[model samples]
Target: MTAQNEVTFRLTRCRRSVPRTRALAHAVLGEWGMSQDVLEVAELVLSELVTNALRVPVPSDRQVGVRIARPLEDGLLRLEVSDAGAGRPEVRAPGDEETGGRGLLLVEALAHRWGVEERAGGIGKTVWVELKAPDIVPEPVGREIAAAMVRPGYRLRARGEWRVVVSVRSEQCDAGYSAVVLGLDEGPALRVQAVEPLVVRQCEDVMSAAIQLEIAP
Candidate 1:
């Protein structure tokens, strides 16, 4: 695993408190100027995992906790919701016209990648989701395209699949800057190479022009 930014929050094992979890997510993402579309998706992922934990029986007075971290360089947002439930979660297949059974489905759809893992200390599970953020301004053109498709900073992959992770964070040196890092798991990683910076500026300009055209008459 690569080192990056990480934050954790605990949630009481109650369905009524799920909104509080969503509120926390909103505040964190808002600090980064994330689009509402991304925040809505993250909230839904939290709701699904937390709801599932509430349905299961937990040992003693244990509660649930949600961890939100974005690795500094990877430009990906990471979410983990953990509970002391005894069993593993299974994704259910939905039938036509079904109104529910879609929470995990939403996770798979909105997240660039997601999974479940046993918590490090003891029993229970952590359901995690990661989303790729647009890299900081002035990113090299080739890296920008690669980051978008490759999942900003994913450092590790599963045993078999070639997975990626990205992390993002704001830092201050002479001035403030946002860093995007990329990670590749279970395979060889690539090194960065230089490209004509002018080409990059042109690409960004083209995208900006296209957006303006869409809004124009």
Candidate 2:
């Protein structure tokens, strides 16, 4: 597979995603014909990365992204977990009998090479790990679809009021389409879109309000 060949999962931020991250990596690596030992280590590495990623302070509706990639002509399997979050990870000395705080330390032990890189647009950073790939031929697969950033923050009527956009990525669907997933202060979030009539109605509201203010006696 080429360097361009990669798969990304946009994840919902929650405790349930810890297992979901492992499952997604297992499925993708299994399809690539990776060995059991390699799969196990990759899963462990990913679990730690995902756990720490969820710790970052991000909005409930914001998503974390995980990407699996193999660079062209490189014998390394790369795993990356990205989020629109703030924080640079650093290994700390865990005291004896310490119950936790050894996430990055485990990454260093398992990964051949690991580091942090600034994500595009400088909105966040990606923590990555590279492992030696077993001598196995990958199954034939096509490249994942490319998506463009549509909005930095899409304001829409969600949760019975207007709120900031959680995510907005424009993807091709025989032509073009986009969707929004918003979070509410309480209860479950909703998925909505701006259709033709909604667009026209909003324009009408804007005009009426602007003209109404001008009609003072």
Compare the candidates by TM-score and give the number of the best one: 2
Please give each candidate's TM-score: 0.57, 0.61
* Model 2: pairs clashing at backbone N, Cα or C within 3 Å: none
Question: On residues 70-150, what C-alpha lDDT tens digit does candidate 2 reach at each position?
Answer: 666567889999988887999988999998899999999999999999999798899999999855453333221111211
Superpose all Cα atoms of candidate 1 onto the true structure and report the RMSD in Å to 1 decimal: 16.6
- lDDT of all predictions: 0.59, 0.67
Q: Which stretches of candidate 1 lie over 4 Å from their true place?
A: 1-4, 97-99, 135-217
Give the alpha carbon lDDT tens digit for every residue of 89-135 in model 1.
Answer: 76777998897787777778788988889999878888888887653
lDDT score at residue 57, model 1, on the 0-100 scale:
79
Query: For all candidates, what are the clash counts?
Result: 21, 0
Worst 10 residues of 2 by lDDT: 194-203
RMSD, every candidate, angstroms: 16.6, 17.2
Model 2 residue 203 distance off true place after TM-score fit, in angstroms:
60
Candidate 1's TM-score: 0.57
Worst 10 residues of 1 by lDDT: 208-217
Alpha-carbon lDDT of model 1: 0.59
Count of clashing pairs, candidate 2: 0
